[model samples]
Target: MIIRKATHTDIPSLVILMNNFRKFYQQESNTEEVKSFLKERMDKGNSVIFVAILEDKLVGYTQLFPSFSTIKLEKIWILNDLFISEKFRGLGVASQLLTRVLKFSQETHRHQVWLLTGNDNKSAQHLYRKIGFTNTKFKHYVYNF
Candidate 1:
């Protein structure tokens, strides 16, 4: 297995994985929209994505969007998406992807990395805790437009 930063050439695979992730969250899948969204992020250089490969096949990915903490005055990464194909689950793919994200954060001198997953996503929660993430005192609230 190999894990590496995603480049423009990997957009097609990224789109597929992203759609799968959306579907997992019960969102309607729109390939074109997903492609456009990811393309914009890649073009603007506002996000970092890592892909996992096995036997030359793309198996999984995680995406991080850069942000900053006003109080801390430091860079942070919002881990917005993580997905592994059903066939590729249980193979440590998500764990490897997260490890790479943390390594990148440290190397870039980022102050922190954070993520949110579905409340019912027990599997993901387990993996996150196993990898050293913890629940925080703060609650995450969002107002969608």
Candidate 2:
């Protein structure tokens, strides 16, 4: 398996993985929209995406968006998406992807990498904790438009 940053050439394979990820979250599947969104992000260079390839096949990916922390007065990263193909699960692919993200954050001197998972996602929670991420006391809230 190989882990590396995503490039323009990756968008096609990424779209499939992204669609599957959305489906896992109960989101509607829209390949064109996913492609457009990813293209925009790539064109703008506003986000960082990493992909895992195993035997020449894209197996997993994780995306991080840039943000800033007022208290830290420095940049931070929101680890927005992480998905491994169903067949690739339990193979340490997710952990490898996350390790890459943390390495990236360190290399870029970011304050931290933040991520949120559904409360019901116990498996993800377990993996995160096992990888050294601690549960925070802070509450996360969002207001949908």
For candidate 1, the TM-score is 0.97
TM-scores of all candidate predictions against the true structure: 0.97, 0.97
After superposition on all C-alphas, the RMSD of every candidate to the true structure, in Å, is: 0.9, 0.8
Please provide, for model 1 over 70-140, each residue's C-alpha lDDT reduced to its tens digit, 9 standing for 90 to 100. 97899999999999999989999999999999999999999889899999999999999999999998899
The lowest-lDDT stretch of 10 consecutive residues in candidate 1 is 64-73
What's the residue-level lDDT of 3 in candidate 2? Answer: 96
| lDDT score of residue 40 within candidate 1 | 98
The residue-by-residue lDDT of candidate 2 on 1-145, one tens digit each, is 8999999999999999999999999999999999999999999999999999997999999999999988788899999999999998999999999999999999999978889998999999999999988987889999999
**lDDT for each candidate structure:** 0.95, 0.95
